[model samples]
Target: MSTVVEILTQIRPEFDFSQSSDFFEDGMLDSFDLVTLVSELDKAYGISIDGLQIVPENFQNVAAIEALLSRNGVVP
Candidate 1:
């Protein structure tokens, strides 16, 4: 699976995603970015994260994204 940072970079390489705890609050990501991220995540991890898991909390940071991926059957 691609790391959250990697996927995020593909979507928005201008920002550094690791320095912030809340991407949304920090203005690092928006709703459109989130949708693109979900698509990349599914393609990279072979795990489908449906709408239920596409909430802000689940995408706050790298840790949150990893946790979400784990819940969706990703190993790490």
Candidate 2:
């Protein structure tokens, strides 16, 4: 989603999220970023991301994030 890219860019403008597959493995995002991202995602998509859903795997890339949103009953 373009909104996903926009949110990520707002969080960390230096990196090109579209080019990265694994944000954590590639060192593109840290734990702090993850926390902030969760907050942003929750607000932007109207879905709460917490507990086990906050794992690294769910925040690894755009695809993973999309899947997480879907699991949380968010359409996209």
Candidate 3:
């Protein structure tokens, strides 16, 4: 599995996330997905993401999500 997928297995997507450049824009993810992803990310990275950091820009794609984890102090 891709790193991003590994980090978010709790909210498994039927489609391959790696194929999408922008999960939100592509309709691969939505508001409910974001909430589930955030919870999964927090658990996987052992960091609490700030409520303010939960934005579409931060979850636009795999790279963006990785960047968000880095911002939360999860070693890249």
List the global CA lDDT of all models: 0.89, 0.89, 0.79
Candidate 2: misplaced stretches above 4 Å? none
Two-way TM-score contest, 2 vs 3, winner: 2
For residues 6-74, write the lDDT of model 1, one tens digit per residue: 889889999998899999999999999999988999999887898899999999898999999899988
- Candidate RMSDs in Å, in order, are 1.0, 1.5, 2.2
lDDT of 3: 0.79
Q: Any idea what lDDT model 2 has?
A: 0.89
TM-score of model 1 (CA atoms) = 0.93
- By TM-score, the candidates rank as 1, 2, 3
lDDT of 2 by residue, 1-76 (tens): 4478899999999999999999999998999999999999988987778788889999899999888888999877
TM of each candidate vs. truth: 0.93, 0.92, 0.86
Question: Once superposed on the true structure, which residue ranges of model 1 sit more than 4 Å away at CA?
Answer: none
